[model samples]
Target: MKDTLKYMGVVVVFLLSLASCTKKWEDHFGSTSAQKTLYELISENSDFSTFTDLLNKSGYAESLKASKNYTLIIPTNEAMAAAKADYDFTDTAVVKSFVGYHIINSIYNVNTGVDTVKALNMRNKYVEFTHGEFDGVVPTQSNLIASNGIYHVVGQPLKPLQNIFNLLKSKFFSTKQVEAIASFDTVHLDGETITYHTSPIWISEVRRNMTTESRKYTYFVVDDESYEAEYAKLKPYYTTAYEEGNTTRPDSTTTFFTKKAVLRDFMVEGDLSPETLAAGVVSITGTAFQLDPADIISRTKTSNGAVYRVKHLTYKLSDQIKQIKVLGIDPRGYKQNDKRGNIFFRDKRDMNGALYQDIEIYDHKVTSFYAKYRALSMTVGKYKVYGRAIMGLAGDPQTAVFTQYVHFFDPSIVAVNEPDLYKRPVFNYLGNADTRMAFEVQPLNPNEVYLGEVTQDVYGNMQLLVMCNGTGPIILEYLRFVPIIQ
Candidate 1:
C-alpha cells in the first residue's frame, strides 16, 4: 500500500512542475512584460551604446521608467548604418528624434502570439514597418527580445513625426511651384484626363523639363477676378536664386512640387473647375510641350470656391525608368536569327514585335513575372548613349540616323534623326559576347545614355545615331517611366 502511494505522489509532482514551466514562458511576453525599468534593459544590452546615449540626453529615461502603458521599438547599432547610407550618422539631434518616435508609451508586446495591439487599429492589431508605406512609423534593425520589451532593426536613425516631412524633402524629394496661363482643365490626349496623383515616374519627368523662372511661382485658380491680385502677391516668391556669386540659380524644391501635386488641390480638395463659371484663373504648362502656359490639370470646388493645385516647388524626377526599360529586353531575342532589321519580341514564337513585346502595364501581378535585366544597350558604330525610346517604337525609317534604342521594360524607345547609317537592312550586331555580329548593329553603347529629342520615322523601324563614350558594351534591361499627363 505504501509503495502505491509513493508512485502516485511522484506523478502529481511531475505534473505540477510542467504546468509551472509553461506558465513562466507565457508570462515572459505578457502585457506586463514591458513594465521593467529602462536602465535595467540597457545595462543588460551594452551594445546599444548610441541609442542609450540619446535616451539619456533627451531625458527620456525617467519618462520611460515611469510609464507602464507603452511599446518601445528599439533598433540595434547595425540598423543605424543602413538608414544613413549617404549622410553622416554621428548627428546627435537627428538620432534622438528618430529613436524617440519609434517608442510608444503603451504596454504592448508585438512578440506575443496575439493578433492586434490595442494601439494600432491595424488588421489583427499588428503594426508593419515596410517601405513605400506607413510614413509616420518605421522598422528598426534586429528584433530584440527581452524579459520586458521587444526591439526591431532599422537602417537609419529615427525621425519624429514632426521632422518626417522635412527629412523626406531633403533626401528623396522637395516641393516647387509651377506657373502658367489659364485654360480649361480637361483634354483628350490619347483619351482620358490624367489628373490627380500621377505615378512617381511621370512626376520625375516634369521636374526635368521645367525651367527656373517658371518653377518659382505656381499659378492656381482664384477666379477670374482674383488672377491679377494673386499673381502680384505670389510674384515675390519668384526672385532669381543665387548660390555663391552673382550667377542666377535654379530652385530645386519648387520644381518638384509642380509635378508631385499634379493638380494643385486634388488631395486637399476635389475637382474645382466647372464650366458654370465663365472665365477663371488657371495654372499653365500645356500637354506635349514643357514651356507653354496652358490649362490647369486638376481643380477642386470647396466652400471657399474654386482652387487649383499648381506645381510651385521643384524636384527632379528619377531616371530609374530609363534604367528599368533597358533591363526588359527579351533575352530570347538573342537566340533568334535577328540577322537584319529583325523585329524583336518578348516571346520566341511571336516576332511581329507586338506593341508590348518586352513592356507591360504596371500591374503587380503580370509585371512581377515578365520583367528582366533592369536596362539594355548595344555598341552601334561606337557611340553609347542611353535609349529614351518612345512607346511601341512607332517610327522606324531606313534613312533615319541611329539616335535611339528600344527600352525593354517600358513600351517605348528613344530615337532621333541619326546622321549616319552603315548598312541597308540594319544588320544585327550582338553585344560583346556574341562577337559573330549575329544581331543588327544596335545603337546604344555601354555606360552612357542620351538626353536629347528622340522621335520615330514613318516606316516604324527603330533607328538612332549617338555619340557614345563608354568602356564596356551596351546592356539592356527593364524599367518604366510613366509620363505625367496633366
Candidate 2:
C-alpha cells in the first residue's frame, strides 16, 4: 500500500513537471491556443476572404500552411477590389508573382521596434517595411502573431510595376520613340530565341538598375512637347548628314548619337529628392543643369528607381565641353617602359578642384602617350587643346625643362605632323616655384588649331600623342579641348 502511494506521488510529480514546461513554452512563444497558421488565420477571417481566394488560386495556401516561419502580408477585400479594377488578377502568373511578393521569407515582428527594415519576399525582391507601410502599401491591421509566423493586413495590394522600358513605352514616350525603344535583335541559343534591345539611351541603364543592380537611380524625363522642341533644334544638324549623302535616315545622325547624349544628360546616378535636384541637377553625362521645383510635372517611384517629368530642359554646349572628362584615355595605359628604356608611372592627384591622373616620366626620353577624342562636329569650328604639365626639380641645380610633341590625327588615322601642331615647349617650367603648371597648345600664329572642314571620311575624330623628353619627371594632368567661338 505504501508502494502504491509512492507511484501515485511520482505520477503527480511527472504531470506537474510536463505542465510547467508547456506553460513556459506558451509564455515564451505566445499562446498557441489563440494562434493559428497564416493559412488558417486567413481562411477563418472574413476580412481576408479575398486574400484567401487569391492564395487558393495561386496554390500558395497549402505552402503557407506548411511553411515553418514566414511573414505574410495580405490586403483586405476592398484593397483587392481596388487593385482588380487596375490589374488583371485572372492571370495565374501575375497572381502568383503578386502573392509571392507579399510573403516574406523570414519572420518580421512589427512591434519589435524596427522602424524600417527590408524584408526578402518569396519572389526574391525586397519588400520595404515601415511602421505604417509595407512595400508602399499602408497596413490596415499589423503585427498579428500566428502559429507559424506573423501577418499584416494591408489596405492596398502590392504589385511590381513594369520595367523602365515598358513604363516609358506606355505613358511617357511618343509612338516613334516607343518603336525605337522596342527595336531589338534576336539571338538563337540552345534552340531558343532571346531578344536583345538596341535602345542605347538611359533605357538600358534604367532597366539594368531596376532588374539586376542594387543601386538606385533618379531619371528625369522631358515631356513629349519639350522632347519634340529639342529635336527640332537638332534636326538641321542631323539632316545635314543625310542631305550630304553620308547617312540614309533623315535624322540618323541625331537619332543614333545626339539623342542618346541628350537623354543621358538628364539622368542622375542616385535617388535625389526634388529639393536636392533643385539645388543643382548634375547628370551622369557630367553636365549640370538647373531645375525649378515648380517645373516638375509628375514624380513616380519604381522598384529600383524614381522618375520625374519636367516641363522643359536645356543643356549648353559650353557647359558640356567644360564638364566633359577626357574620353578614351587612361593614365594607366601610358605607364610603360618604352623602347628607349624610359619609364612612365601614373598616379591620381587632385588638381585645381578636380581629380586628374598625372602621368610622370622618370627618364628624359621621348615617351609617347596617345588619346582619342570622338563626336567632334564641323559646326563647332576650331578648338584649343589646353593641358596642365608639371616638371619636378631633380639633379644638379634642381632646374627641369622638357619639350612636348603634340600631334593630332584625323579620321584617316594618319598623324597631322604640321609644325604648328607639334613641338610645343615647356620653357615655362623653368622659373615657376610651383612644380605643377597649366599650359595651352594652339597654332603658333593662329588663335587655335584649325581642324579644316570636317567630312564623313574625316569622321570628326582626333587622335593625339604627346611625346616628352625632359630633364626630370614630367607630369601631365589632363588634356582639355575647348571649342573656340568663331
Candidate No. with top TM-score: 2
lDDT tens per residue, model 1, 177-278: 222211111222455543333334333433222211111222242233233333343232222223212112112222222223343321111123335223
C-alpha TM-scores of all predictions: 0.28, 0.66
lDDT of 1: 0.33
- Candidate 1 lDDT score at position 472: 16
What does each candidate score in C-alpha RMSD?
A: 21.9, 11.1
lDDT of each residue in 436-485, candidate 2, tens digit only: 22333322211222112212222133444454433333345455555544
Clashes per model (N, Cα, C within 3 A): 107, 0
TM-score, prediction 2:
0.66
Taken over the whole model, the C-alpha lDDT of each candidate is: 0.33, 0.56
